[model samples]
Target: MSMFDNISVVKKANVYFDGKCVSHTVQFPDGTRKSVGVILPSTLTFNTGAPEIMEGVAGSCRVRLAGETEWKTYHAGESFDVPANSSFDIEVMGDPYHYVCHFG
Candidate 1:
């Protein structure tokens, strides 16, 4: 099926981090959930329980995956992967970091 062909059912999550992040949580028929949100300029670390794909939807940001010292940049339409049971650092640039996180 094409994208958005059967996307009429979706759920909204409460404003998180005092509105710094907001997103729509979508659950497909196969039981996968994806969170799409925008992250304000901030430095944060995240741990993943399941494998995730974080895609940049608007602004850009820098990320340092676990076991790496160098930071890589990801711009709009780009994406990065976080392995299950691992952590990563996120450095938001000058603008909001709009993203869609796909979980499996």
Candidate 2:
């Protein structure tokens, strides 16, 4: 799971939050798509169109899902699910957080 084989990557970067977050689309042979990206040290909100599984690759982050009061921490090799049409707040400090977003 460290690398993806037989996949196509979109050349254009998906940049947001004044460049606080940047990612590129990775398409698989089966037509599923994912995003590989890094989130710089910042607090940000993201809205999702599709149900997603956020897999951490490096570093760590504190996440507060919509309507949640407690913030949870996720490190490398951890994953969190976000429901479709919902949003979450993520706070990254110190090192940049690297992740792969699986879309369903």
Q: Which candidate leads the pack in TM-score? A: 2
Residue pairs clashing, model 2: none
The models' CA-based lDDT, in order, is 0.82, 0.98
Q: Write the per-residue lDDT of candidate 1 for residues 61-89, one digit (tens) a residue.
A: 99999999999999988999999999999
Q: Which candidate has the top score in lDDT? A: 2
| TM-score per model over all chains | 0.83, 0.98
Instruction: Give lDDT: candidate 1, residue 99.
Output: 88
Error of 1 at 34 (Å): 0.7
lDDT of 2 at 49: 95
**Cand. 1 TM to true fold:** 0.83
